[model samples]
Target: MNAGFDVAVVGSGIVGLGAALAAHRRGLRVVVIERGSEASGASVRNFGHLCFTPQAGLARDFALTSRELWLGLALDAGVWLRESGTLVAARRDDEFAVLRDLAATRGVEVELLTAAEAEARMPLAPGTAVGGAFLPRDLQANPRQAVAALAAHLEREGVEFRRRTTVGAVRPGRVETSRGPIDVGRVIVAVNHDIDLLYPEVAERHGIVRCSLDMMRVAAELRMPLAAPLLTGWSLVRYGAFSATPAAAALRERLHSERPDLAALDLNQMYTRLPDGTLIVGDTHSRGATVAPFQAEFAFESMLDETRVLFGVDALRVVERWQGVYASGPDDFLIEEVEPGVHLASATTGIGMTTGLGLAEHVVAAFSDDVTTTADEPGFASAPTTTLQKGAS
Candidate 1:
């Protein structure tokens, strides 16, 4: 095996791949090491929503930068990217109020439309939507395909990848892997929910926890061209920019009163259509480093029940069900130097797809200095309290 490189990335998720790209761009010999044969974690399990409209502060900046990177890669790497913005359906007066408040406060390009208008623009059940907001900047892609394309692109560009290789230990100038030890100049471990395996002390001290969510995919009744991803009243309160609005408290109260069951599971309904005429819907959030092996049937039931009410559809043909877990910490992401040349970068929240690219750039930059010790690097200190909010938003 080629054990020599200027930089070694210890995971193949979006953040890891992004770091490898950043290092290669700086003329560094970079190699990505992955325990799995392919990218099979949160990066592939997400909704693939490269959404920035709902982000605020530093997260918004990162999302914008990542969006540019995604677009360029989609074109250059032949990855499928759908220019689908988000259409949030407001089924009640309170939800509409929250959307209006968000539109006014967040200076993004948003359009307010009547129930009829929203239904006409997107395929929703009749009279189900009272009104909605159309955010035009959001985009979508197939998470599974995007990650594969990205890794493939890196390989073609001279970056090396050692799959099915686990890192046993990380130190200043060498990585002890399951296969063997490799000499490396710098090491960045971007492992997502499994950071404890490599740096338990760092993960625990940073207050990092795992956030698990339920997701489902179903067959569409017909081949309908979905102009954008569809969201519901729950989503109005799920996203940060919308939930932070003064009107959000009232909306949440209404939801709790009207549909306590959905509130219990943290259920939020949003659907995106695949090219094969299937709809991907889901998700409920539960926080813990270790989740139960079993999935609750009620979670899926709540999602489907809400989908029926919002879309006014009689039934949704359930196809497949699964779960995704990501690391969640005190901030948008946790970046700290655990050793002199080893840095740990993990997006503790769910916006890995939205901000992973830009975060990787910052991670690589931290190693750009001439100093040998991490203490010499200015940005190697503890991570900042991210201004971006975490949750469904």
Candidate 2:
């Protein structure tokens, strides 16, 4: 079978869907090809915390754009979105210095809260915290539902989807899939960690590899009115916006001295309360060409222990545990023309939910402009024709 469209997206994750949506809005007929029946990759296996404040430099701008895009998509699709901000509490003096520095930034919307103020807003242990800052710009959503809803919304808007189909090769204006070929004006590959499957040379040249994370979800015995995601000193040392500051080194030293185990596991302790009252907590970072298939018990224990220490609670019950992998490179993202008429865009970091949509927009705009300029150039076709055949899951 052969399918014809103006734009063919090789992956149906958030990044691919974002590209399809942007192209469709520009009056381009788009079709998304997914290897699975649904989006079951890093898109759905994340915390779904749109932490814009923690993204520094150009990454921050993308986060802001993605925030707006997410809101509109959720509203249009009737998906549940929790406008829960993020509260990063400083547990140590060094961490306090970082928070204070961030609060002093003119354009940043972070409020430095005292220990008492922090406790008043959330159920934190009194007299045990040095300082904290609240970022009202952060947002949250149900990861399991948001991606699916976006795909469904795109489908409803007349974007075709070829689910359960693998893309085997990508050439100029054409995509050879396991089922057949898809002809298009342009092709966007948003396969993330699986980019090597279609462009192994590009992936190897960029030194791209998979970064794995261990995350856990637990049911809290008490339903506290937690308004936003919670972060501790560990997060300040992990998130780029805070960690890139001058005070981050001191905080890292303090953690390595006081909690060497956490440093070893690369743990960043944070928690977000879902609508169903379960807390989505995580995670430890581990990277390699391939990840091992196991979760260390101590990693889970360390997370729970940190949560207990931070909130003065010990009633958390583990409900689920899982691992997620994402494409990682030297930079926060990778967008390049791996082949003629084919553009590759990937959120090389784990913050795809935060910046995927914005990157997609950029890829679409750039590809569109390039295609128009080169419409008369060699090796470019402006027409297409095909018939579709449904594939088995």
Candidate 3:
């Protein structure tokens, strides 16, 4: 292979892939270097749900643009994107009101439904559900399949992917990898959490921090199955994006102050159905540098316990389990050209899957001579080691 290229992208996660593809589309020669044999980290983790729900207004615009970008890329790449709408089951009346507000919100096409209406669509939904909000345009995909398809598509476009290569040092116009140094005219560091490692003081400048959580996949319950990626009242509290909403603020205060399990446990629930008829049950967050040992028995019982209470599906069998981590910040996202030819970006929030393409596309635009200036942009706040949100779990 050639010893150099026009641009070098670090990390093969979705964000890195998004940036690489964007740059390649712009006619720049690009090479992607990843540490693992294949793309890992948060790329192929979680529900693979293309989150359509807006994060205030920021995610609204990004997600809308990202949807268009994702659809276009999948069409060109022949990747399968499931049109699985998201159902957010609201347990409280206030939760239902949030759905009403979201229905009127721009970017996201939400529909508020009564319990009967929601159950009619998926009769198997928990009878305990009082009502729900459905995002009709949201979708899902197999993360591994999509990323692999994307890599192959990039290969077809003559884009180079250097797998099993680890980057140790990043400099302007050059990147030093485990394999060796590669010369380039521009560099984009999309290594996700390792963003802090590459830019050791990144935490100080970019405010990069990590959130660790558990995710599990469950087998189908015989003939019955879930209709889509479903989130109950529990999930609203788990994901800060929802919890941070106006109504969610009151709920957050209650859970933080009154509820013992919620305040101490920080448990949030998300259940997404897979093509194989299995349900992808997840996820609870605890923010810290290190995570506790995988409590296989606890995780198993805990998730299933939640599933039983939240979902009506019975006889659901456990199939697979895994853990995931990602970068998130206090504000919407950390998007800035920290240095010339060195673009630092991270989706510490769950928006990586929800809004990655557009965000990466934005990075590509910054690579231009106009946006790639040396001066830092104003009003763009840096992520601090100590944030007002108490760091995500």
> What overall lDDT goes with each candidate model?
0.80, 0.80, 0.69
Q: Write the per-residue lDDT of candidate 1 for residues 1-393, one digit (tens) a residue.
A: 865899999999999998887787667999899999998999999888877888766666667767777777877677789878888878788989988897788367788999788778877767777888899888898898999998998999899999999889899999998889989999999998899888888888888888889999986563236677887777777666777888999989988888888888787678888777778898898888797768989898888877666566776799889998889776777877778888887777788998888777767766775212244322222222244344334
State the lDDT at 62 in candidate 2.
61
Q: How many clashes does each candidate structure show, in the order listed?
A: 4, 0, 4
- In the predicted model 2, the residue pairs found to clash are none
The positional error of residue 81 in candidate 1, measured at the CA in angstroms, is: 0.3
How large is the C-alpha RMSD of every model relative to the true structure? 5.0, 7.9, 6.0
Residue 278 displacement in candidate 3 (angstroms): 0.8
Instruction: Give the alpha carbon lDDT tens digit for every residue of 133-191 in model 2.
Output: 88988898888989889889889989999999988888998988888888888899999
What lDDT, from 0 to 1, does candidate 3 have?
0.69
Q: Per-candidate TM vs. native? A: 0.91, 0.91, 0.87
Which is the winner by lDDT between candidate 2 and candidate 3?
2
lDDT of 3 by residue, 69-144 (tens): 6776667776668787888877667667566655765555677889888666553445765788787788887787
